[model samples]
Every structure is written in structure tokens, then in C-alpha cells.
Target chain A: MYPNNLKYSKEHEWVDLESKKIGITHYAQESLGDVVFVELPEVGAEFEVGDSLGVVESVKAVSDVYSPVSGKVTAVNEALLDNPELINQDPYGEGWIVEMEITGGEEDLLSAEEYERLIKEE
Target chain B: MSQLKRTPLYENHVKAGAKIVDFAGFAMPVQYTGIIEEHNTVRNQAGLFDVSHMGEIEIKGKDAGKFIQKLITNNLEKIEPEKVLYSPVCYEDGGTVDDLLVYCHNWEHFWLVVNASNTEKDLDWFNKHLKDEQVTIENISDNIALLALQGPRAQEILQLLTTFDLNEIRPFRFKSIDIAGVDCLVSRTGYTGEDGFEIYLASDKACFIWETLLEKGKGYGLAPIGLGARDTLRFEAGLPLYGHELSPEITPLEAGLGFFVDLKSEHDFIGRKALEEQRAQGIPRKKVGLEMLERGIPREGYPVQKDGKEIGYITSGSPSPTLGKHLGMALIQSSEAEIGNEVEVIIRNRAVKAQIIKTPFYKKEDK
Candidate 1:
């Protein structure tokens, strides 16, 4: 499990600010079940808050990954194409779906504690 | 609304941490660990399932055989004592009322296991039709608990506990025997396309049998399975479910179950006339298998399009655990129901390319 140092989205995606690179949290992967396939946005693709950025498909169903904040995708997780199970194994660390360059400061995102509480309510 | 019905194993499922869901007016476990894992366990090893909610009806009398022959599509004359035959009970209009397993114990005693949701309808159909026959139809579903132990190692695990020579029992064969000091009826039948057995016992004895099997088969890798994997496994095997593939609006011939319909028999069945007429005219629609050729996966109720026109709808769809491919069964027009034909499945409002393929998408090799 990843540490509670990053902001999270209600859709289960997490944003960790480490030298400007943002990644998904561990909670996202567990909720998504086994990640058989993932479709991430192309690098350099601009996105606004709530924009559909990608899709994560499990054996049961497919869920869309949305942009938590307005930004441009800097890099996509290329390793997910062959071994999507990495998301289930290491969600917050090596299984991040995309690295985005934040165009603006996080305003609508929930803090680590708030996101944890939100998941509990769910 | 009132709370949904619970089976005898409801508490057991909850104690085992199964995620419960509403199914056919019953609160049942959809998955224990996960659907994919439980499905693979059943395919490679063995898994136990709680199917106590399935409806069982008993018919006994001198005319029981004669009466059931006219009720279902399968020819009763071919079935001997201790043999179970799977068939669909159809309406006079050639539409399927329900798919059931008819167990012939002797010349005068038989049992029919039907879908849980169709219990009331099946009982009424039997009572209405058998009024003139010298038979008694009784709905014994509430009194019986059905447990299915399915997979490759199912027979070996079950044989260890029972005095009955299970190896002598061939497929679709069943016998009443004493196991764990309790008299129960065991059948070598399953829906998962695996070599397995289904046991019917008193509701009080269900927990004992379940616990005994788990304790005895621990070394063989037996896990408690749930309805989630059951659906995916059956879907991968191209088995037709009542509401999805076999419905009141669909005939068995159209649902790719013609093998179970014995038209060659001279016995007059309920839908024999309409079935013969349909056979002569050729089936209007046929159930075909679909494999996704594009990136997206299809789901139930999704529209199947061919050349920009809707030709069919997917009845059951899922990512196959054994094959690792997205597969589905679609009820398509007979003209478009050919293997290798290209079709498009509308998934998430996008048309994804798919191809018509032969059923049983995942084949199990001989053990």
C-alpha cells in the first residue's frame, strides 16, 4: 500500500506531486480489480478537469479514467500494454498509468485524508 | 420491497467473506475472492458452489414417464432409470418456457430441476398439463439443498467420502446413496463444461457436506466458488441461460439447443408441432458466438451491427478467464449467423469489430 501523502480523486485516481510528475495511488488499483488492459491518453494531449483520459478494463467491467486537473500528458505507462497486472501488484509505484505536467495548481482535488474518508463513505 | 430470499448456505457464504448480490429474487454470493480467480480454479482444479436456490420438482405415478415425455422436448423413451436428460420445456407456440434437467429414477418416479426464477411458471405448467394423467406433481425445491462440486478433481474428491462407486457413474447419471451418514442424491452433471457432480441433500446436512468436502479436499486445492465465476465460466462454455439465451420469446431450435430436442421420436410433445414447422421453414434467428476483433469488449444487451444495421444483440458477454479473449453469445439473424462472418458490437456507444465464431470458445483438454 502507498503512503497517504498524495491528493486523490473520487474516481480513485491519485496525484502525487514529486518534482512535477503526477501518478495514480494504490487505492485506485485495488478498486479496479485485476487490470487486464489499460488505454492512456497520448503524450502531449491536453486535458481539462473531468476529461476522459483513459480506460482501465478488468475481467468484470471497464471504467474510464478521468483527468483530475487541467494538464498535458507528459508520458504514458508503456509497460501496461504487455503486463497490466503491474497495476494490481504495484499501483502507486511502478503501475502509474500516466505522468502529467500540471498546467495549474490543484484546487478541486481532495487531500490524502479527505480521499481516504471519501473511500470509506463509498 | 421485502428482503430477498436466502438459501441455507447464506450464512456460510457471509462467513467466508463472499460479496453478496441480488440474483433472481435471492441474495446470493457473487464472488468470494474474485470472479476470474474462482473461474480459473474451477477450470484447472476443483471448486464448490452453493446452488441451493435451484428449484426441484418431483413427479411420480404410473404415467410419470408418459406425462414428462409430452412436457419437455427431449424424448423420454431414450432415457433409462438413473439417467438424467437435459431439455427445454417449451410453449405450444415453439417458445421456450424453461430449460431443465429431467431425472428418471424408474418407470414411475422422476424429478425435474428447473431455474429458480421459473419455478412458479414451471409448476403451473406441469399441474395444468398433467391434470388428465395419472401423476402427482410436487414442488420440493424448498425442502432440498443443491450443492455442486465441479472441476477436474471433483470426482476424486467426492469419491473419497461416498460409498458409491462414482467412477461407474457416467455423465448425466445419478444415484441415491449414503454419504457422511446422510442419504443424498448425487448426479454427475454440471454447467461449467467441467467433469463434476451435483449433490442434493437435506438443507440441514448441506453445511456438513460442504465442510467435509473442503476439509477433505484441501490438499487438492478446492475453493468455495460463487455465482460470479459461475456466470463467467458458463458464458465461456457457450451455455444458454434461461433469461439471456432461452426465453419465452426464443425457441430452443433458435437458441442452438436443437441437439436436446428430439424431433425424431414419435412421441407428441408440447411444442413438437411448432418445432417441426419451424424446422421445415428453417430457423429465423440463431444463437452464434462472437469474439472481439477490435480493442473494445462487448456486453449483454449491446447491439450487434452488420453493415451499419442492427442484426442481433449480445445475450451474454465476458472476458474469458481460460482463453484470455473477450467472448460473447449473440442472437443473430439466421442469414448472418455464419462462422467467420464480420460484425460490429456497439460497446460504450462505439462500434467495435467482432467476428462470428464457433461456440465453446475455450476447449478443455483430456485429463
Candidate 2:
């Protein structure tokens, strides 16, 4: 379910406005199959849009989680380090990866309607 | 990106909500419910697999036995009809051409079951070496379909299908029998290191047998497994995948498969000279098992190091679902392959500490 409240990125990541939290989308989790390990960026790490912030490893392969918006890592998801399958079970809620103070790249985000259309075209 | 081939059971996998991926030019299912769960099913209960992508070649003639004697590494003097032999076909330089199973029916006819990806190359190699032998070879891969039922409960599930005494066939032996009304060549052999059978039948009859097995096996806790769990199961069992453990750059002896290589046989096979030479000179590299001492999952192609110098690389690695440990197999220098030797796996530019441990990671308790 693509929620209307969150803005989605072309890389299959979603961002929440009120909580300033970031997480992968449902499509991402489904495509990854099963998440076995998570590598989170250090707290206070600064990065720009398109920079790799963390990593998600599945049973067969590994994928990089890219930053959709430029910001400093305010908080990290410690729970994912122990239980990475949270990303596959609930990618939008408890599966949130990091929280940050939005700095730039706001125009690059797409609405839920536009993101749905983009995935359809893919 | 080219047109991928599909097995006969492709539609069945799609209908069961499987994640399809390209495997050796075939559109194959990589997972069904999940890899870990499916892996567990085969260890604790029973699981079915559509291994139709494997290649089967038939050789029949007066010289069929003698022709294969020069092609494979293992000695066939002790072989009999209805028996299977696992051996590696090598090149002139002692590198691996492929690892395959030879199903011996008699002196005049035999079947070679090879890896799916190596089918074309193996066929070409087999043809190129044909000297004045009376052997006639044919590729029967497309006409046949293979299905494996493997696990602790595999025997119980398969016994309900056929009236033939399944107990009559021993491990590494095959018998032609009627299964659910279809005639099939069933072998009590598998790659999962369990008590199981690999059934070979007509291509058209694959779907019917698949459905019937799943239907009847419902009460026995049988589930459909995919390539993902198939790989993990084989890896945890310490089986060598062709491309990973044995390859064109790797020899069977270096991969720790010296048991299958017969160096003292009177008949000289391909690569025998090189293998003998290597044996005389001492094998330079050895395959060893690595267990992570620090946090991090080792993966294929990762560099292995000792004292800041690159020693070798990981051929295959993953989190063992059955053993619940981060494990890997590496082809490193033989001097550094001793048990309890400390090493490092360079993951993402960081060296993760690991220790050399006894291989196979997991073994089934004796029944």
C-alpha cells in the first residue's frame, strides 16, 4: 500500500514529513525477498542526495540504501541491526531506517500518486 | 536480457506466487514462501524441487564404456549397471570442465547428467574428443524433466506414489518404475545431503507428477522449494557448486575433491598428466572453511587476507540457515589453510576477522 502522507523516491524509499523518518518502500522489500542483515550509517554522518547511507543484505544478494535528501543523520535504527527482517515485514512503520533534519533535495521527491505511476511504467 | 527459457513447471511456479529469476538461461523460481523457511522444511520435513534445467546426455554404442573412460577422472572398473558415479570432467590443463554424474546402465549405454549452464560447452567438448570410437551421443535434456524430493521424510512421501518396493533401490542406484501411473527412472540420489530421490520422466508429464506429489505430500509437511533454498541447503551440506568451488581456473584436487580423482589408474584420462604432476609437486592452494569471528557476512568474490597480504578469495559464502553461523569457503594458499588458522575477509573495504574451521558446517545425524 502506497500511503498518501509520505513522499516517495525513485529508488524505492519513502520519507515521512512530520516524524522526519526514512524507510524503504513496500516494493523494495518485496523485490529484495528476505532481509538478513542491515548496515546502518553512523549517527551524525552528513550526506547529500544520492549518497549511500546504509546497506541492506538479503539472503542471496546485497543492496545499497541511498539517501534521497541531503541531511545529517539525527538518529539511527538500532533495532534493524539485530532483526533486519523488520524491513520485509513492515517497511513503512517499525522498519524505518533513520531520522534526519531535511536540508535539501525536496524537489526530487515524488507524491504517492506519481510514484505509483512511475513503478507501473517500470 | 535475451529471451530466457522456461521449464515445463514454470506456470506452476507462477501460480504458486514464486519469485522468478533468470537461472542458467531459464526463467526459474528463486523462492516461494521464503528462502529460510523453505530451507528449514527440507531439513526437518520434506520438500520438492523442479530441477528440470539440468542437462542429460545419452551415450550408447559398443564403445560407450571405453569412450567415457578417457573423458572422466574417476575409474569405472568397479561400475555396474543401474549405478551412478560422481566425477569431474577436466580439460587438458587440469582445470575443470564440469562436475557431473554418470548413470551407468550397461557397457553399451550410459547417461551423463551435467550442470545446466555447462550443457552446451560439455556437448561441444564431448564431440571434439570423439576419436574412432563407436559411441553415439545425443543431448536428451529437452525431452526429459527432473524433480527431486529430498529431506528426512522424503522416503515416506515417495513410498505412497508407487507400488514398486522403493526399498529395493539403494543409494546411488536407479530403477525404472511407475509413479502415479507415469513411467520414470527414479534414483535415490540428491544434492541436499539427505535421503531422497531424483525422478526423471517425460517432459509433458512433469506438471501432473508435481501436482500429485504436492497434493499427496500435504499431510507429510511437504513444501515446494526453489533455487534459493536449494543453494543454501547444498552450501550448508558442504557440497561444491561447479562455478564456485570448481571452475576453469580451479582443479578438483585443489578444491578438496581428491577422493574422486584416481591418479594410480592404468588408463590415463584427460588432465591426468597435469594432476599427477601437481600431486608430485604438491598442491599449491587448498580449499578451507571459514567461520566469522567478528560481525559481518562474508560473500563471494570477497578478498581473503593474512597479515595485510592478499592470500586468496572466497569462492562461496552465506549465513548458514541450518547452522545459524556466518560461514564461507575460501581457496587460499595451502600453507595458510590449517585448521584454527586466523584470517580476515575483506568486506566492503573492512577486514573482518575469521578462523579456519572444519568444513561442511553441518552434517545430518546418523539414522
Candidate 2 lDDT, tens digit per residue, B112-170?
99999999999999999999999999999999999999999998999999999989889
Q: Could you tell me the lDDT of residue B259 within candidate 1?
A: 93
- Compare the candidates by TM-score and give the number of the best one: 2
The Cα local distance difference test for each model comes to 0.87, 0.93
Model 1, runs deviating above 4 Å? A17-32, A44-47, A103-105, B128-130
**Candidate 2 ranges with C-alpha deviation above 4 Å:** none
Residue lDDT tens for model 1, B1-367: 1499988888889999987878888889888988889999999899999998899999999999989989999888768899999999999999999999999889999999999999999999988887678999999988899999999999889988988889888899998998778888999999898999999999989989999999998899999999888988888878899999999899999999999899996888998999999999999999999999987667789999999999999998887889988888999999999999999999877899999999978667776
- Once model 1 is optimally superposed onto the true structure by TM-score, how far is the C-alpha of residue B313 displaced, in angstroms? 2.3
Mind sharing the TM-score for model 1?
0.91
DockQ score of the complex predicted as candidate 2 = 0.75
- Candidates, DockQ: 0.44, 0.75
Please provide TM-scores, in order, for all candidate models, with all chains considered together.
0.91, 0.98
